[model samples]
Target: MPIAGPWIQLAVKPTAFDSDDRGTWLIFDGLLQAAGAALLIAGIATSGGDEEPALSILPSAGPHHAGLSLAGRF
Candidate 1:
């Protein structure tokens, strides 16, 4: 029953490494988590801002052979 109480408390807590000290590993963990979230958001936000290249495909046939050409513009 004692072990079960601690397990239940751990499961109910929001952060596993919660601490009262400001200068603890929890602060660093929070900073790292925020930085990662910011980077992810920035990447997602800027991903669609770039213009895609225009593509062209040309096909040609001659008396003896056939060929295809591909071109693109940024």
Candidate 2:
């Protein structure tokens, strides 16, 4: 819906937008937004489920250093 703002503006009051190629740019913007949404939906719908995700963190210390180790699975 947010992506339709420009289209609505152009339709209701074409003179509001001052861009030289407002229609062209709006078309491009709509296409890009649609493509991005499609990709996002595809990614979420097809995410892998083969492994149970896991994560662990371990603290480590040495003579002159201290750090944490991170391990994970997705």
Candidate 3:
């Protein structure tokens, strides 16, 4: 079978709708990259390799209550 590379890849900034030239693009791209990096770092620091959001609070009583549980992504 033929290989398909990056069927969908992380976007390079200067989104598809942008109209900036290369010079302006680098600055915004850098800013975008920095923001993404910071977000990644924050996510990693919080979840380590387990990316997930957990219930912050649990109800004391309820027939449908599941209490608190892990909700993972990837």
Candidate 4:
């Protein structure tokens, strides 16, 4: 059986996050996610509303390889 672990993330902005593993990162995906989050936060904040930094749990590498991303955002 494949053991699974939760997705780990480091937030570059509210509503965005990054993974330490290469699997989740498409070409420029990380930059986009971070930038998008930043923009979203900035937009919301600038518009005068409540915005919170959020992290979404992406489908992640299973527990067998869990520690692969344990060192924090790489």
- Cα lDDT of model 2 by residue, 1-74, tens digit: 75676677667655655658877777787778778888878866674877666789989889999999898765
Tell me the lDDT of model 2 at 52.
66
Top candidate on lDDT is 2
TM-score of each: 0.35, 0.52, 0.36, 0.30
Instruction: Candidate 4: list runs displaced more than 4 Å.
Output: 1-27, 48-74
Error of 2 at 64 (Å): 27
Off by over 4 Å in 3: 1-20, 48-74
* Candidate 4 Cα deviation (angstroms), residue 55: 22
**Clashes per candidate (backbone, < 3 Å):** 0, 0, 0, 0
Report the number of the highest-TM-score candidate: 2
Rank by TM-score, descending? 2, 3, 1, 4
As a TM-score, model 1 comes out at 0.35
Stretches of candidate 2 above 4 Å error? Answer: 15-19, 52-74
What's model 1's overall lDDT?
A: 0.60
Q: Please provide, for model 1 over 1-74, each residue's C-alpha lDDT reduced to its tens digit, 9 standing for 90 to 100.
A: 32244345445557645455433544465566667778877865664546764689999789999999888654
Ranked by lDDT, the better of candidates 3 and 4 is: 3
User: Could you tell me which 10 consecutive residues in candidate 1 have the lowest summed lDDT?
Assistant: 1-10
Give one digit per residue, the lDDT tens place, for model 3 in 1-74. 11111111223443565454654655565667667778887865776464465444444546876566444443
